[model samples]
Target: MAVSRPTILIPSFNTGPLLLETVEAALATGYPVRVVIDGSTDGSETLLEDLTATDNQLRVHILPQNQGKGAAVLFGLEKSLEDGFTHALAMDADGQHPADSVTAFLELSSRHPEAAIFGRPVFDDSAPALRVNGRKISNFWANLETLGWGIDDSLFGMRLYPIRKLIETLEETRFARRFDFDPEVAVRLAWKGVPIVNLPTPVRYIDPEDGGVSQFRYLRDNTLLTWMHFRLMIGFLIRSPWLGMRGENPLLHLSPPAR
Candidate 1:
């Protein structure tokens, strides 16, 4: 029999257009997967209900009101823990993540069985001119705020998280919601001694014809990130030499499987 795989959790809100492809991609990992629907007023919930009925490995959780993405993810993580899963992989419902690359990512986890596999996205030309350029700005600020700790791509959404540590972190900390979740969780995990293994995976941005729907509120989310780094920078300043001395991205030189 195939090894029982780790559960995949997708937190979706109004991702109806992308849900089918996303869930299919998650299931293609040859693992059990689930989607947590956070107050989706759209037909997305109905669509997932149908999907759940047919696939024994697929499950859905529907909430009555829309909580933030962090809340949705937390619910999924709790369920995974209850089900005795050791890790959870999170992907955006959008097609930004390459389902094909997922095998390489999961393989690494299977080997290491200890490290967090993080995706350092290799962007394609199909990517938005503005978002692409804008994220570079966020990357720079995040690296500097960490005092050049060497995070390859700070804003990439695809990441594998260690379940127990992630649960504890989420319980103790605030502000892993919205766009800030990507960077904040990575940085905090680093602080807690969870080694980050970066993998260079190609990231594609499907166009509208491919059912692309982006809900990123640039102004609002950017403001949140700026504030987040403001706090990180202050902490860095107080412990500058210490944090700078801390090593990061040590695994970047290795051309391991793409996350």
Candidate 2:
């Protein structure tokens, strides 16, 4: 029997110029693809309309107002489940993630159909020094939240999602939206007995001179993440045994490396 091919879903928000690069890279892999426009006023929707018009494999979904990326993803997940697609690989329109890695993630998803595949980024010098360091704090908190659930990096935007389980997760919890979305999703999915597989891929942070615009807010989003983990901790308490007995990571169980 042929391996089941999964669909790829890209959430575009104010992402017009770089949107097609992401789409083209996705199509280059020969997988079914779709884009969800989360209320972008930028003439980008017209681009989406045009793209979908020509490519029978490309479909676009739109929302009226700018709900956050989490909301757009939730919208896409629902539609993916409704459309009968088993898997959806999510990528950002901002060209931060590598296209070649996306094809690899989809292939991994095919092998471990029950697990979510996360892109563990291989960052270049263009990556922000501060953001790079800040991830350690999030990584620490995620490990604590899962009793060391083996989350390599929680903020990577590129990941392959299993639609049915993700939809079930979205319905069960209301915390994943905005910047807190990625970490919350990755951690919680790990808690719910969903295996996570990491694939190393290059991530580029383009200079603003190169038409790059980032929407990350450090203080505000970090506070949101704090609250998200607070909520996840409460759920973790209820699901304590499951997380505790899930597995053992010697790195997590071992003491911090000598400073």
Highest lDDT, which number? 2
Per-residue accuracy of model 2 over 1-259 as CA lDDT, tens digit each? 1355588888888876778777888777787888888888886777556668778888889899989989899998888778778888888888897777767787767777887877777888999999998888888878778886667888888988888878877777776867777898888787777777777778998788887767788888888878887887787788887777777643332222211
Off by over 4 Å in 2: 1-3, 248-259
In candidate 1 the C-alpha lDDT for residue 129 amounts to 88
Point out the worst 10-residue segment of candidate 2 by lDDT: 250-259
**TM-score of each model, paired residue for residue:** 0.89, 0.91
State in Å the error of residue 81, model 2.
1.7
Q: Write the per-residue lDDT of candidate 1 for residues 141-168, one digit (tens) a residue.
A: 6667665544667888777777887888
lDDT for model 1, please. Answer: 0.76
